[model samples]
Target chain A: MAPQSPSSARAALFDVDGTLVDSNYLHVRAWQRAFREIGHDVDAWRVHRAIGLDSSLLLESLLGDDADSLGDRAKDLHMTYYLGARDSMRPLAGARELVRELHGRGVQVVLATSASEEELDVLREVLSVDSCIAHTTSAADVDRAKPDPGVIRAAMDRSSTSGETAVMVGDAVWDAEAASRAGVTFVGLLSGGISRAELEAAGAEAVFEDAQDLLDRLDSSPLARLLSL
Target chain B: MAPQSPSSARAALFDVDGTLVDSNYLHVRAWQRAFREIGHDVDAWRVHRAIGLDSSLLLESLLGDDADSLGDRAKDLHMTYYLGARDSMRPLAGARELVRELHGRGVQVVLATSASEEELDVLREVLSVDSCIAHTTSAADVDRAKPDPGVIRAAMDRSSTSGETAVMVGDAVWDAEAASRAGVTFVGLLSGGISRAELEAAGAEAVFEDAQDLLDRLDSSPLARLLSL
Candidate 1:
């Protein structure tokens, strides 16, 4: 059941991959590069749908259970390559500023992503606003990644925010699905490469170009009233 | 990564709804009763696939985006009737004895269920084996209830078990899908009215007629050593 709203939310959950940073394409590129090196010809787009999934599940979704044929050798290959690509990380336009804005308004901001710890470290460095982050969740902390809401619950638990007092913003269908399943208001961001239709279909109640758009239109969104900004 | 294992596992995860208990048909019957009450005509088999899903999502899956118009109301009505029907709950033939056997052998047993807390109480009362259960999960704790691994993870976490240390047993394709997604070994139980091919297609590594059959042929099954008997 959806939690009853308190007229004001205490936090805003943000998806780190494509929603806060312009890295969904990079992840696709990295997975494609890694899979190719391991002798698998996987479609990058297909890899994208399964992006926010946990590592093994993502690989399984991409290469099937038989990818086990390659074993640990394949896992190391993907991690090393994906980590190497981290140098290309960049925050989506306005992500940093909006995060700061929310923090100023006393809204606890959390980073919930399906990215592994190694990936989040790079993101943390790139985003460079350590004080603004109230909490963060990665695949390491959750057994089932996005579209499951475990990370969201973990993040909320860390921030001490009740599900009723929180909202999630993300750019993928998985994010929308997770938010919907978790019974939170879902705000879709287009910067992550997922279409608005896909996000809406998954259950986003509102849409924006990215964090910047959200910040600019906060007054008209649930966020505006939520944080009284 | 596949959960790190200790060469061999001694614990197993069993799904509740259709696997150890013949409740899928009852769930379909209740849903049929509720859907019709709310003025929607949904096929029973289609509703059966949704058995493991959270009631609202199950309705949405069947009734689509606009399902709220009738689905929400129907869900309450369905549960209203199903809740009353709990007195009819019965354990599949070998379920009780298998739990007792597993308890005696010192093999850990856990329930990975999508049942509501209300339903779980009924099941516990009906199954009458409280001391043997090491862990249990309900829809309240997870987002993607099934066809996702959150419930399994919650159970594993509560049981202090890892994915590699666990083997999921269940009756439906969704249970197999969740266990597969979690990278756990899956054993299918036919008591839920699902077929062997369907279970295997969803990713079960083996199939058993019921808990007693599994107990009767424990030596033939890979999980035999993990059983308490």
Candidate 2:
């Protein structure tokens, strides 16, 4: 590829599950069932709050000491239950349009997610805007999942952009913390059932109702400011 | 029943679904599926926020004009999906113990829910502390659901308790609003995935992590204050 100019190097990193797709609650339910199958009864709301963490980290967080002995089985059970519910997944309102709009504005769109390679494929299919996506990072790309900032840095590296030239959009506190740690601007969406207050407290510079709301207010949003930069 | 002394007439009205039972996310999923089946494709988080509303009102709020054409069918679909997932329902930590503790304290425990009589039966079974429950009010007992205050008032009346002598515990903003309107103190629970800020803003006088946390802090809680009144 030819060398790109600095202005043309701007990028937008996206979180998939709860940000662009309606799958957070499914993950919560699956994890709840998985914990139960392993003889640990975890609450759904607890799992919901823990959704953006990597599966192993989530199991460890919810199961504590029991995670060592039951983690692998619970992880496998979660995968089975989650995959069984995969057919129900759908893109959030304007998810495809928002990504396409960002790409059309000359901003590279990178999917920065901790989802496994197989799960990423399904999510990409659901999003159906692969043509607009310039780069993607998955669990395979990083040693640590979100709230660790490794995945955000990896996505920025893959997109050939610096944190200053990119903005991260997600629906969970973990995503906000990760982006903040990576020195990137963070925008939050409430589509994940996390309240705006929680997201703002976690370091989101802007909060929207969902992909559609963000798209509707794109002109005044941080994404617009980043593009102007 | 014989007339009871005023001190023994203190009551606690409970919202069952997300407050005591770990079923809010299930309700969100079921509503999402129900809306999709009717071709609406509602977001899960939106359904989640609207969980405490009566089924008809929830449909109307989500579907708007489309609800006029699709309300009954969507309601039926939601019931079917929710009931199918009934076996997955479990009580939140200390749910049983909380009710029994209140009963042991001479506080009449009344389940004030907009859940159908049939659904309430299943929830009561999951809670398995019916003997500690002094009374219960369902959708059948009132023409309006939460945020209307009618159900809360009905529940208080059934328990022979005045607003000053009762407190409401729930996991939704609607519950807080209803309790506020009914002149009763409201205690919010985060087990419903609602943020503490949202609950407090909605008029919750106190907030707890869940039934367990409230039970752990009962001596300092509004429940104790009511008893002292």
Docking class of 1: incorrect
Q: How many pairs in model 2 have backbone atoms within 3 A of each other, for residues 3 or more apart or on separate chains, i.e. clashes?
A: 0
Worst 10 residues of 1 chain B by lDDT: B1-10
Tell me model 1's lDDT, rounded to 2 decimals: 0.74
What lDDT tens digits, residue by residue, belong to model 2 across residues B1-229? Answer: 2225755678889999999999998899888888888899988999999999877788889999998889999888888999899899999988989988888777888999988988999999999998889899998988989889999999999988877888999999999999999999999999998989999999998999999999999999989876565
Residue-by-residue lDDT tens digits, candidate 1, B1-229: 1113444335667887766665665676678678767766554335655677666668788778658687768878878888876754567778888877776666667888878898888887878887887677887888768887898888877766676566788887888888888888888877665556677878888888778788898767757635422
TM-score of each: 0.48, 0.97
Name every residue pair that clashes in candidate 1.
B94-B212, B102-B228, B105-B228
lDDT of 1 by residue, A105-197 (tens): 878888977677887889988899888988888877888887787888887777667656788988888888888777788899877655566
Worst 10 residues of 2 chain B by lDDT: B1-10
Docking class of 2: high
Model 2 misplacement above 4 A:
A1-7, B1-7
